[model samples]
Target: MGIVVNQSIKNTFITFVGFAIGAMNTLFMYTHFLGEDYYGLTAFLLSSANIMMPLMAFGIQNTLVRFYAEHQTEEEKSRFLNLMLVLPLLLVVPIFIGLALFYNETAELLSQENPIIFDYVWMIPVIGLFMGYFEIFYAWVKVHLKSVFGNFVKEVLLRIFISIFLLAVHLNWLTSIQFVYSLVFIYFAMMLVMAFVAFKVRKPEFHLQFPKDKKEVLLYSAFIIFSSGIAVLLLDIDKFMIGQYIPIKEAAYYSVAIFIALTISVPMRAMHQITHPITTDLMARKKHEELNQLYKKTAITLQVVGGFIMLGILTNIHQVYALLPEKYSGGISVVFLISFSKFFDLMLGNNNSIIFNSKYYRTVLLLGLCLVVVTVGLNMVFIPSFGIEGAAIATLISIGLYSIAKLMFVVFKMKLFPFTRKTIISLLLIALTFVVFYFWNFPFHPIMNILLKSVLLAVWYWFLNYRLAISEDINAVVKKGLKFNTPR
Candidate 1:
């Protein structure tokens, strides 16, 4: 818990800083500098690349985290790491060949609605290749329990680079096409930096010999490829599909709402950086009790923190939209729907790490595949009718059903549940706070209104949570921060 809290706090802070920079780029710079059409194209390309990333990396990122602890000796560890590095090429080489062979057809298919996408379709695989290896190296550091630097590189440095590139575009130093092409270079550079940091953490010895458990390792990696792809698909497919089904600029609109909603998941993302490795270690050691305890603690902590973020976003959603251009304001409903879904995901805490590391991972993978089909179908049915809001509806339904299924699977199979009486109390507190402050807005600028409401919400929310002791971990941190002793 000490290491978990320490790193999570640092990671959360880093993630918030990253999000702050990202918000400026998404809300202001991209909107003002890139315009809606190009912004949507940028969003589409990235989302498409993300959907391709897992396949290109061949699931080595997740495999490393899950299997690295099983090796008992340095020789075995080196062999395992070597295999992780080499396995991705098994798929990457063939995928590249296929992309080259079918480049015209592939580009044509993607650019059916928007010919602008045809020229940029090549960037998807290039960026996805970079993204794949980046995660592989990022996972390399995570297995060593040195996630902070890698996270900084991931969450902070990448966005900062994007900001610089966008600023360059603003200055007429780079055309919109050049700015799009720069994504490939940016991701490739970041991947190399992550690789360097990973090797410095623990340089792997070169070896051709595979681990003794090569069969299980390959099997796990294979399942993980689809499972990881399925997960990524659930997240980014909506944006990609939006580009296909509607005007590409709608993807930009959806991206804005999604970014705002994405803030609610920051704590979970930060905590997962450390908890994933810890959860993998616990499962490897078969420490059920500790695992269950971790499951609950992480759940409550994230719920409390994420709930606050969601409240801030939802209560002040109109103000947020007010700051954006009138063309982008239609996504207010998208923000609410996606924010609710993201908050639900955060409340599950380390559920993903727990399930992915468990033996029943294959079952979950199959379930995820099914949900992917459903998500696609829903998008097909809804997008033409409801536009970006329809995409949000599809996402909300898919994620809600998916989250509930994962929670049930963990509860039934592992005899573990993350919810408690405190969970209900946290919900009540969130609802109460939202009701009290949501309708009451300051008669001031949008920025000032947001600040005033956020401060009031924080004080009221945290005070009750600390007083009621909803989470011992959170209460301890609050006490430590304030340097005060309070009766439990």
Candidate 2:
């Protein structure tokens, strides 16, 4: 727990910095520099690539984390690493060949609704390939218990480079079209850098043979592709389909709102980088009691942190949207719906890490496939009727239900539950804060208003949690920060 808290704090800081830069790029620069059409196109292209990444990476990123600790000897671990590295090519090569073979058809299908997508369609696979390998190498380093550097590269470096590219476009040093193509090069460059960093961390002694549990390894990887693929699809499909059913620019509107909502998940994302390997190790050791405790601690801490973020966003949503262009203001509802959905997700804590690494992952995969079908079907029915808001509604429904199912499974099958009395208390505090602050604001600029309200909310919320002892982990951190010599 000490290591988890320490690394999570570092990761949270890094993610916050990265998201701040990204917010600048997404809200102001992308909206101002590139028109909605091109901005939406950028969102569409990246969402398409992300949708394909899990498949191209062949779930090996997850497979490595789950199995890496099982091998006792350095020789066995090296052989396992070699196998993990190469397995993705078996799937990626065939997909690339197919893409090349049917490039025109693929472009045509994507551009059927918006011909603007035609020119950039081919970049999807190119970017997806690089994105996939980036995850693979990032996970490789994670299994070595070194995730902070990789998190910096993924969360910070890429966004910094993208900001530079956007600035290049603004300066007319390159046209938007050239900037688009430059993204492909940027992602591939990051992939190569991560690969180098990972190898340097623990130089793999490459081997061709597999461990004795070869069948188990292969089966787990195969099933994980479906499970992890479903998860990515759940996150990105709404954006992808928004482009297909409506004007591509609607995706831009949705993207802005989604980015605002996704801020709530940053803590979970930060914590998960370190907690995932720990969850896998605990699960393998059958430390069910310890795992359950960790699960509850993470859930409450994330909810406490994520819930406050949601309050901040929801309370200042009107001001936040006022800072955006008129065309993006309609996405205010999109922000609320998706913010709640993300908060729900954050409350699940390391539930995903547990499920993905458990023996019941295959069962979860089956359930997830069913939900994916429901998500797509709902999006299809809803988008034509409700537009961008409809997509948000569909996502809310699907994700809400899917999270429930996962929570129930973890409880019934594993006898683990993340919610505690403090969970309810935290929810009440978030609600009370939102009600108190939603109608209150200063006669100030939008940015300053947001800053002031966020600070007030943070001080109040953290004080209540600390005073009430809603989470021992959070309170302990507070005590340490305040230099209190308290008994454990």
Candidate 3:
């Protein structure tokens, strides 16, 4: 808990800073500088790359975290790490070959709706390959329990670069197309920086031998590839499909709304950076009791924190939209729908790490694959009718069903549940705070209105959570902030 709290706080702060920069890029720079068409194209390319990333890395990132704690001897560890380094080539080499053979065909298929995408099609795999290895090395550091540096590089570095590049586009120093191409270079830079940091943490020993559990290791890695692919697919598929089904600009609009909604997941994302490795270690040691306790703590803490973020967004959603271009304001509903789904995911805390590292991971993979099919079908049925909002509907439904299924699986198989009385109380508090604030607004500028409303909401939300002691971890932080000591 100490390490989790320490790192999660730092990670959360760093992630929020990154999101702040990203918000400016998505909301203002991309909208104004790149215009809708190019913005959408940029979103589509990145989402497509994200969907391909899990496959390119061959799930070695997840495999490393899950298996790293099992090796006791340095030689054994070296063998396993060396295997992790090499295994991705099995998939990477073949994919590159296939891309080479069918580049034009692939480009044509993706660009049929909008020819602009054809030129950028090659960037998808290039960026995905960089992103895949970035995660692989990022996981390399996480296994050593040094996640902050990696998190900074992951969350902050690229967005900062994008901000500069977007500004360059505005200044006419770089064309919109050039700005798009810069994504490949920035991602490559991130991968290289992370690799350097990872080696600094612990330089890998080159070994020819494989771990004795090579069979189990290979099997787990195979399953993880599908599991990770399915998960990424659920997240990025909507933006990808939006480009295919509608004018590419709608992907840009959807991307902005999604970016706003994604803020709700920041706490979970930050916490997961450290919690994942810890969860993996616990599972490897078969420490069920500690695992369950960690599960509950992480669940409530994230719920409390994420609930506040969602409340802020939903209540100020209109004002937030007011700040965006009029053409982009249609995504207000998109923000609400996606934010709710992300909140549900936050409630499950470290559920993903727990399930992915467990024996029943194969079953979960099958479940995820089924959900992926459903998500695609729903998008097909809905996106044409509802537009970007339709894609949000598809995502909301798919993620809701998926989160529920994963929660049930963990409860039934592990007898571990993340919810408690506090969970119910937290939900009620969120609803209450939202009702009190949503209809109320300040008679001021949009920015001022958002600030005033957010302050009031934070005070109301955090004060009660503290009063009721919804989470000891959160309460301790509050107490520390005020420099108060707990009674003996």
Error of 3 at 24 (Å): 2.2
Q: Could you give candidate 3's per-residue lDDT for residues 79-130 as a string of tens digits?
A: 9989998888998899889989999999999999899998889899899999
Q: Rank the candidates by TM-score, best first.
A: 1, 2, 3
Question: How much lDDT does candidate 1 score?
Answer: 0.92
lDDT of 2 by residue, 98-201 (tens): 98899889899999999989888889988998998999999998887777888899888999999899888899998888888898999998999999999999
Between candidates 1 and 2, the one scoring higher on lDDT is: 1
Clashing pairs in 3: none
TM-score per candidate, chains pooled: 0.90, 0.90, 0.90
Candidate 2 Cα deviation (angstroms), residue 186: 0.8
Tens-digit per-residue lDDT, 1-488, candidate 1:
57756777788789889889999999999988998999999999999999999988888998998899999999999999999999989988988899899999999999999999998888998899999999999999988878888889988999999999999999999998899889999999999999999999989899768999988989988988877889899999999999988999999999999999998887888788678878989999999999999999999999999998899999999998998889999889999999989999999989999997888888988999999999999999899999999999999999999999999999999999999999999999999998998899889999999999899888999899999999999988877977766555
lDDT score of residue 86 within candidate 1: 91
Which stretches of candidate 1 lie above 4 Å from their native place?
1-10, 67-82, 143-145, 199-216, 274-294, 484-488
Put the candidates in lDDT order, highest first: 1, 3, 2
lDDT of 2: 0.89
